[model samples]
Target: MNIHKFFANDEIATRPLHHVMRAGIFLSLIIIIFISMSGRPLAQTIEYDLKSVSVLKINLPVSQAVTIVLSDAVSKIVAANAEIADAQPITDKSIYLVGRSFGTTTVNLYSESGAPVGLLAVEVGVNSADISRSIRAALPRSDVKVNTVNGRVQLSGSVNDAYSMEKVLEIVAQYGSPSIVNVITLKGGQ
Candidate 1:
């Protein structure tokens, strides 16, 4: 097999070389398209309302939070309903908006001059992170873990008694979990 025959020298072998080149190019194009389609960016949107315009319309799960960074420095932050969500300002331009309950709330932002900046319309939904956190908070000594599998909240790990196990499940239900997987085991060991 003469490698030179496949190059510019031999005109007869050019036909085969052309087909190979086409195949390689076709494969490369397919790979590029697949890569582009597979990896997509998760976008978050800001609500632009006249009455109470929002900086972010977040569909956050309960027990979880997303950080908000404002272009203008925020002086004061207020959540419409603390039962649904809470806002904690980390800096002048950033705050951590945490989902507290299964409901909707808006966090109003203010500037240094006491002017309204924007609002964050937050909808707290069910998720494993929130459920896990809730369980841990309620029972700090319990070794329970939580995760979402196939849109269901799965609870794992060991507990000292059935009361602790039941308490963990109750917290998951309060978060409006679609389904609960109670794999929690009651053991004598801590």
Candidate 2:
């Protein structure tokens, strides 16, 4: 019962202390090795073609039903097209629905000059949540950005010109809720 007796007995305790210290060191080394191995990066190439992208969202609400339907429809359409190889799920619930099914189909729509030529938006009605989710999902590879402020979804990004801006607007218009007040596009200032 005496705590001091264990440490005071040199012959009985010295060997155990040594063993415990060794085990502690061994465990520490194993942990270090495991962490280092997991942290090491695999050989990979970072894409230099990436452009700056941003998205601004307005304080709005989107319905879930519309988002689900739109994503499903778009995914099917893009899948049947030969030009679109695949669609990846995006962060935006609305767009993510399509992206999840279609697999990055938007990237395929870019023109040779790095301009967006076409957009596929759902004509169906959705709520604010679905719309916001879909837009957020789709913004990762997008050079511009999407965001919401004071019940409005704001689009800010670089495009070829006014026509391209219109095209972008048309694409997003499909997934909007019935009560969506506006679609605002801020030109990349040419």
Instruction: Give the candidate number with the greatest lDDT.
Output: 1
Worst 10 residues of 2 by lDDT: 64-73
**Model 1 residue 143 lDDT score:** 89
The numbered model that scores best in TM-score is 1
Question: Candidate 1, residue 123: CA error in Å?
Answer: 0.5
What's the lDDT for residue 108 in model 2? 26
- Expressed as tens digits, the lDDT of each residue in 134-166 for candidate 1 is 888999999888765534567889888878877
lDDT of 2 by residue, 135-178 (tens): 44544333345544432455565554566555556556775422
TM-scores for the candidates = 0.42, 0.24
- How much is the lDDT of residue 129 in candidate 1? 67
User: Candidate 2's C-alpha lDDT?
Assistant: 0.38
